[model samples]
Target: MTAADWHARAAAITPRTELFIDGGFQPAASGERFDTVDPATGRVIAAVARGDAEDVDRAVRAARRAFERGDWSLAAPAERKRVLLAVADGIRSHADELALLDSIDGGKLITATRQVDVPGSAAILQWYAEATDKLYGQVAPVASPDLAIITREPLGVVGAVVPWNYPLETAIWKIAPALAAGNSVVLKPAEESPLSALRLAEIASAAGLPDGVLNVVTGFGVEAGAALGLHPDVDVIAFTGSTAVGSRFLEYASRGSIRPVWLECGGKSANLVFDDADDLDAVADAVIGGIFGCAGQVCSANSRLLVQRGILDGLTERVLERAAALTVGDPLDEATRMGPLVSARQRDRVAAHIASGRDEAELLLGGDALPGDGFFLAPTVFGSVPDDARIMREEIFGPVLAIAAFDTEEEAVARANASEYGLAASVFTSSIRRAQRVAPALRAGTVSVNTVDALDVTTPFGGVKQSGFGRDLSLHALDNYTALKTTWFAGA
Candidate 1:
């Protein structure tokens, strides 16, 4: 659609603003609501239900009751698969509506939400649905007539806390696998972007999911998120957000029932460029996309650029030239490649990072907010950055790229792996031997040899160190929501 058509559609949209518990939408227990502002226009789009501990408790109880009733947990694998496939189909059918909700609620580019986030979420759900019946139990070899059977069973009542960045995609990453394994779920979407998840609950119900099988609660992290983490009935808690909040979830889990907590947190990932890189221009393009894509809100955002001292100047110039030409404006506009930050508060946080970056390194390109009604910040680039600089060490989580120079491959690897986060990293080189050698040397969950943040649903996605643990995609993710039970037969 053209920009005018998109703008018209956006204007006509009315997002869901209530908490989705069990099979229907309802107001919060406290009857209080908070406004979710549109970052692009600085207007209140909707006043969403303000869920707190009581609301969370009610949702968890619903999930637990549904699990105990065996409406989903005891369904035949084929039946479960059929229902999940229907859910996937439902998501596809409502793609535009879902995409619009995310774009307006989260300040994501409309094109991205329509083309990438919604489609990817549907595909991920379908992939998990197709894998449902393929999962099998194992038979352990035993002596004589004795038999041993090892079967994986669903962990009932999973609590999923997803971040605002890529809201639907990340929620599907958790929800699909958890549901595929026959577990009931209580989803808590970020307060900033709750509309889509609330609508997703409606879609799932219409797709033949049993009542209370999937629920959505929206509120701030300290209230709703803490309740989920500390709920004794919650068998597992899966979360994606900042490291500080991940730590708080850990504490909450520890203080309560000690449920299994899987976290995918922040990162300051580095992209290494050696002089032997085959295409400098292509590498520069990758650098731009790696850091500035989604305004650098990605968890695996390659915010740090480490280039060999010989080619640093050339590569930095190429990246800056491209960063300057990017169009930043309203998300609903098709021509805008970069939208505003998720909120004015986030823009201010990013501004703080840029201010500190100016003190720590040379501001090579844009570092100021644009003059507009929306919360817009120009893509920033920093050069001659030190290893210990705050911008280099911390996750700015914005369109900020810090460039540093290294003399050798050893130093590059050392510098890249120095962060507390081990989420993702990238390396660019023409030599096969160096690519193979350096990839394993870097301390990260995923290392892209010549690409940045390369990933697929077929491969596992997660990180080590403070970035947290537990896989999120592929067959491995099922392990996070299920546990193996061994049964022994004395005389089979």
Candidate 2:
């Protein structure tokens, strides 16, 4: 569909203006509301219920009741699978509407929302649903008088807090596994982009999910989010956002029930391009896409570019050319290659990072904010950035790339691993030996050879160090939502 079509549809669909709790939409207890704006137009798209501590308390109580009732937590694995599959189908059926809502609310490209984000969200539900029935318990080899069985069981109440970027997809990353593991969930989506999540709650309810199984509380982190994180009844808290916020969740867990906190946080991933790389052009393309494809809003964005000194100039020139050519406009525009940042505050943050790079490195190209109504910043690149430059070290979370030239393999790996974040890294080289050697040497969680930001549902995605802990995508993610119990039988 055309951009105009999407814009019209987005305007036509009545915004869901209430908090989703216990399988229904309701206003906040205080009746307070906040407006969610379109970053592209700087206009309010909808007035969402401004949920607070009381709303979170209600949602948590609902989730706890659902878990204790055993309607979802003790259901047959196949039954849970059936409900999850129906949720996935519901998502697919409403793909266009969801995509449009995401574009308007988050300022992400409509193409990406339609083709990648919405589809990815549905696929996550389906994948976890299929894994439900396949989950198995292990029996320990014991002496004749004793029998030991290790089984996985759902944690009662899971509270998931996701970020604005890739909102729907990340929500699914947490919600899908939590539900498949037979745990009731209370999801708190980022306040900047909560529309899609509210819509998902509606979809899941329509797909036959029991009341209170999947609840969404929409509000600021300091209020509703804090309530969910600190709620004593919540068994686990899964968070995806900045390192600072993830740390807060950890503290909440410690101060409350001491429940486990799973975090998939920020990153400043390095994309290392060696001189021997066969396709400099392809490497250049990966560099552009890695940082700018999502306007560099991704938590695992490859914001650092480490290049061999021999090919540094050539690769830098090619990267400049591509970054210059990227089209930034309204997210609903079908031809837009990049969209505005999620909000004016985010745009200014990226701008501040670019300004810092100007003093610490050579501004290669595109370092200024564009003149427009939306929160648009030019795709920026910095050359000869110092090892200790703030732009190189900090998580800008925008379309800003820092390039540094290195001498040897040792220096490349050392410089790449020097950052506080070890979320993701990419190595572009032709030699199998180099790929094998460097991939293992990098401190990041997921290292890609000849590619940048390569991810799928089958592979686990996360980070370490300050980037935070815990996996998101694979079957291993279920570990965060479930607990292991060992049963012992003696002299049966």
Candidate 3:
């Protein structure tokens, strides 16, 4: 659809103004509400129910009841798979609408929502649904008279706190796996982009999910998120957002029942390009996409570039030329390659980082915000950045790249590994030896060879150190939602 058509359609679907609980939309107990604005236009789209501790209590009660009654938890694996697949189908049918909601609410390119986010969300649901029935138990070896078996059981209730960037996809990343493991979930989507998540609740209900199996509370993180994190009834909390907030979740877990918390937080990942790399042009393209893709909002974004000193100048020039060619404008425009940041506040924050960059590093390319209506900023790059520069060490979460040069493999690995965050790292080289050597030495949960930010549904994704713990995708993710149980019986 054209940009105008997409905007018109988005306007036509009056935004949902209620909280989703027990499989239905309802007003908050306190009757409080907050306006959700379109980040691209700074216009209020809807007055969503402002969920507080009271609302979280209600949602938790609903989830707990559903789990205790075995309405969904005790259901057959095939039945759960059928319902989840149906929900996936619902998402596919409403792809355009969902994509529009995400684009406007989060200021992401509508084309990306259509081509990447929405479809990826559906595929994740389907992948987990198919794996539900395939989950297997183990029979332990023992003496002839004794038999031991180990099996996995769903945690009673799961609380999922998703962030604004790729809200729908990240929400499903938690929700799909929790449900497939036969657990009722309480989803607290980011307050900035709650519309699509509310829509997903409706679709899941229509897809025949049991009432109370999946509930959503829309409100500020301090209110709803903290309550979910501290609620004793919640057996597990899966959160994806900033590192500071991830720490809060840990604190809440400690203050509550000490339930396991799965956190996927921030990153300042490094992208290393060696002198022996076969394709400088391709490496340049990957470097641009690493930081520019998703407006550099991704947690695993390769924001730090560690280039070999010999080829640093040539690659940096190529990257600058490509960055200048990128089209930046309204998110709904199909021709637009880059869109505004999620909000004016985020844009200002990025601008401040750029200002600091001016003093700390050599400004190699764009650094200022573009002249426009929305929160637009030119893709920025900084060269000769000191190892201790704030722009190099911090998570900018914008289209800002910090380039540093190193002479040897040891220096490259040392610079890449020297960070408080170790979420993701990439090495570009044709040598199998370097790929094997560097991938393991990076200290990141995910390391890509000859690629950057490359992820799939079947592969585990997460971080190490302060970037948070636990996997998000793949069958391994089920470990966060399910508990292992051992049973033994002796034959007389």
Which predicted model would earn the best lDDT? 2
Instruction: List candidate 2 segments past 4 Å from native.
Output: none
For all the candidates, what are their Cα RMSDs to the real structure?
A: 0.9, 0.8, 1.0
lDDT per residue, candidate 1, 226-289, as tens digits? 8889888899999999999999989988899867999999988999999999899999999999
Model 3: per-residue lDDT, tens digit, 342-407? Answer: 888899999999999999999988898888667889999999999999999999999999999999
Error of 1 at 301 (Å): 0.4
Candidate 1: which stretches are off by over 4 Å?
none
lDDT of 3 at 103: 91
Q: Give the TM-score of candidate 3.
A: 0.99
Whole-structure CA lDDT of model 1 = 0.92
Q: State the lDDT at 315 in candidate 2.
A: 94
Clashes of each: 0, 0, 0
* Model 3 regions more than 4 Å off: none
Error of 3 at 288 (Å): 1.2
Candidate 2 C-alpha lDDT tens digits along 340-396:
999999999889889889999999888888897889998998999999999999999
**Model 3 clashing-pair count:** 0
User: On a 0 to 100 scale, what is the lDDT of residue 186 in model 1?
Assistant: 95
